[model samples]
Target: MTKIGKLYGVGVGPGDPELLTMKAMRILREAHRVVAPVSSDSAEGRAESIVRRAIPDVTIERVLISMSPQPVQGRDSAPTGGTSADQGGGTDGYHSKDSGYERAARAITTWLEAGEDVAFVTLGDPHIYSTFTSIAAAVIRMLPVVEIETVEGIMAFQSLAARTSTTVCDAEESLTLVTAIRDTSALERHLTDGTTAIVVYKGGSRLPEIASLLRDTGRSKGAVAGELIGLAGERVTSLDNDEELPSSYLSTVLIPSRSMTKTVEAGEGPA
Candidate 1:
């Protein structure tokens, strides 16, 4: 019997090639062809760079995906005078209506159908807000029996903690991971609700508002504000009171829980 081709979705980690997990690196080097999403300008693929640095010998295939989310019109949707097209087209001014992953799914499935082992490389972990989820969903829907594998890479949160020398959370404390860029109110609630640590994943576009909000909350408790942790370029400042915050895609804000106060006050540091 012929062996069924398998698809491996590998996370390459944030920028650093050495951060790749052993399993991810192994699959990238062993896979028949590696795939990465590219920009409309056809510039070098971001995720591809990380993988190439780790396994430079692997053959790579570029799969272009639109970074924009699809705009859906619901029955109860407010009547905007303009359609999605009026919003200046999709990312890179490409007016193509099809979601990028839809195209990516078909491309991946075609490779699998050809009996080739394909590896889809993603920055950070494949499951953590990566576009691989949609592409994988498409593959499974078309070929239910398609073999799939996922290899975890270092998440931005962990990387941020390492860069800032900050503890994400101890065994005795809880960590709440949130993507609060889209929801300011939710983020405010978490900051004040006494979460052991608040790790915000996507804070690029909403940095200004999030910073201001955090600054106010930290002022009452004399907590530092606007801390952007991760990588050598990390900007870990008190956003609650800082005048400026450095920019980065791998940014994460850590709000340590009150339980850590005793240890901190004792000059004992993180648990």
Candidate 2:
């Protein structure tokens, strides 16, 4: 039997090339090809953009992953749960990502059969709300013996905490990472009495609604947001500004829930 090439899912961290882990960089340097997932909705590849700095000389392959939660054209509505384009790991529960995951699985298999190590790069940690899980799940189902290694990277929220000088949580205070939801009410449901921190991913172009929701829920002030963190032309500002938020699909919002009493004092995010 021919040996299958191993697959590595590397989280390149929250947009700063410096944050890329050593193990991830080593894998990138050694991999035969790096697969960067790009959104069908946009021309940019956030993961690939960050990894390129580490493996500038390696061959980087672009794969289109459907991140949209809107029912894909011509397909029946997806069953409850994810698509690969989901902000952190996979799409939120609204849309199905079977097609996109299957496509990526096929691509990874092709590269492996060719005896090439493939690095599937992601932003932040590959395990946290990342499309990596969906793709890896599909690939494993198809080729049971293929070896896979996932390298962890810093999450966007963690970076956001540092950039804004905001504390994520203290002691037992709760923290929630929210990706997508159907409506304002549903979004509010996640904010528990104990959740001290809430990070909203894929807050793309939904700033007004999110901000309104936050205000309605009593988290009226001291929220921070960031877009394209650690990248050139990156912007970090307070949510207090009247600026239209979600400047890019890559935007994130960090709101301090009512439970938080102490403050870190730095928040540069779009509002």
**How far off is residue 143 in model 2, in Å?**
0.6
Estimate every model's Cα lDDT from 0 to 1.
Answer: 0.63, 0.72
Over 110-213, each residue of candidate 2 has an lDDT whose tens digit, in order, gives 88888888899888888877778878888898888889999999887788778866666766777877764334454577764636578887665566777777
Model 1, span 1-271: residue lDDT tens:
4565799988877666789888887888788878887755365565776777777777788877655433355323322221121111122222234556678788888878888899988777787777676678778987898999999877766766565456656676777777643456666767776646676655555566777776566522222323323233545555545457644444556556665544554677765
For model 1, how big is the CA root-mean-square deviation?
5.7
In terms of lDDT, model 1 sits at 0.63
TM-score of model 1 vs. true structure? 0.80
